[model samples]
Target: MKRITVSLLLFLFLVTCSQSDIRHNQDLEDTTYSIVEDKNESVIRLSSLTTFDWEKAFLFSPYSPQEMIEEQLDVDFKDPSDLDMRDDIYLLVFLNKGKVVQYAEIERQDADFSIEGNLTPSNDGINIERY
Candidate 1:
């Protein structure tokens, strides 16, 4: 009975290890952007803007701007217009065919900040940089 229990535990361990390995491999294969950390900030670069979801990347990120603002300033922004009025912000640089098209500077003080831009392909490609 002890031998059987040991064998069952070993089987479960192998299964868990294999599942973790599969997930790690899938994440490496599915990653579309690269993140670089520099001192106090991180830079996210995307080869194509079409695949970039700003709302998901920023507003819903692990360290969301909204949560940061609320924690630091004790203020909340409910409207899009309110974000534009703030001073403490981060920048999103947009490119079309590797050329700069538009940019947005999002204030960290705002609870809900949205990025607006023309993501359509004007030349042959699209790229984005978020810092």
Candidate 2:
């Protein structure tokens, strides 16, 4: 009986933990933002940024030129089926010399404001996308 109870408890714990999807976006305060990709061309320098909380890019950024960074992040959410289901993702990105370029949320169902602090700041030219 003791062993059976213990197994049941362990199984319940794992099942509960794995089903979470960061829905209703109460995890914004626990966000993990990172600065990714910076580069210098003889003609122009470029940089990018993105955010991640518990799931989804919130802001999925790909390395692009400094000028085109904003243009690129026009995230193509083909089917935002879960838009109203729960947590909306938010992301902020900047370019060279602390240039604020993009700051927006995706699929969030709450009115949570972004937490402005450096979870990770760029030193040289780094491109980070959360895993």
Candidate 3:
């Protein structure tokens, strides 16, 4: 009887741990945003910034000849989606509840660049979609 009880408790503990891990992964997925490329244009897309407590959004282009940085974008996504991606490469950063959640690296090629996917920012970076 003692061995059976111990085994049952162990199984419950394992199940609890696994459930917690699953929840954590789901949370990450929920917070992800995406950027996509369509013929001659790149669109910044997200589910809903306010849903994740997103506080800030910004875009910076390091390769541009002139300093171009867009700050304090609409958290509710009222801002324009077609950003002026004049440089070959760019970085899009998003703050979720005062923490950096995105480091999306975007690249544009002539007019042929194609992009699509979940643009959610993570430590590994947000996925950029090209079309």
The TM-score of predicted model 1 comes to 0.21
TM-score of each: 0.21, 0.20, 0.33
Q: How badly does each model clash, as a count of residue pairs?
A: 0, 8, 11
Top candidate by lDDT: 3
Using TM-score, rank the candidates from best to worst: 3, 1, 2
**Which one wins on TM-score?**
3
Tens-digit per-residue lDDT, 1-131, candidate 3: 99999999998887555333211123322333222323322433444332443444454444432223322332222112233534554545456664444434444433222223323332222333443
- Per-residue lDDT of candidate 2, residues 6-85 (tens digit): 99999887655533322323232223221111222111111222243211122332222333433443422121222223
Ranking by lDDT: 3, 1, 2
How far residue 81's Cα lies from its native spot in candidate 2, in Å, is 16
Off by over 4 Å in 1: 1-87, 110-131
Write down the lDDT of every candidate, Cα atoms only: 0.33, 0.31, 0.39
Position 61, candidate 3: lDDT: 46
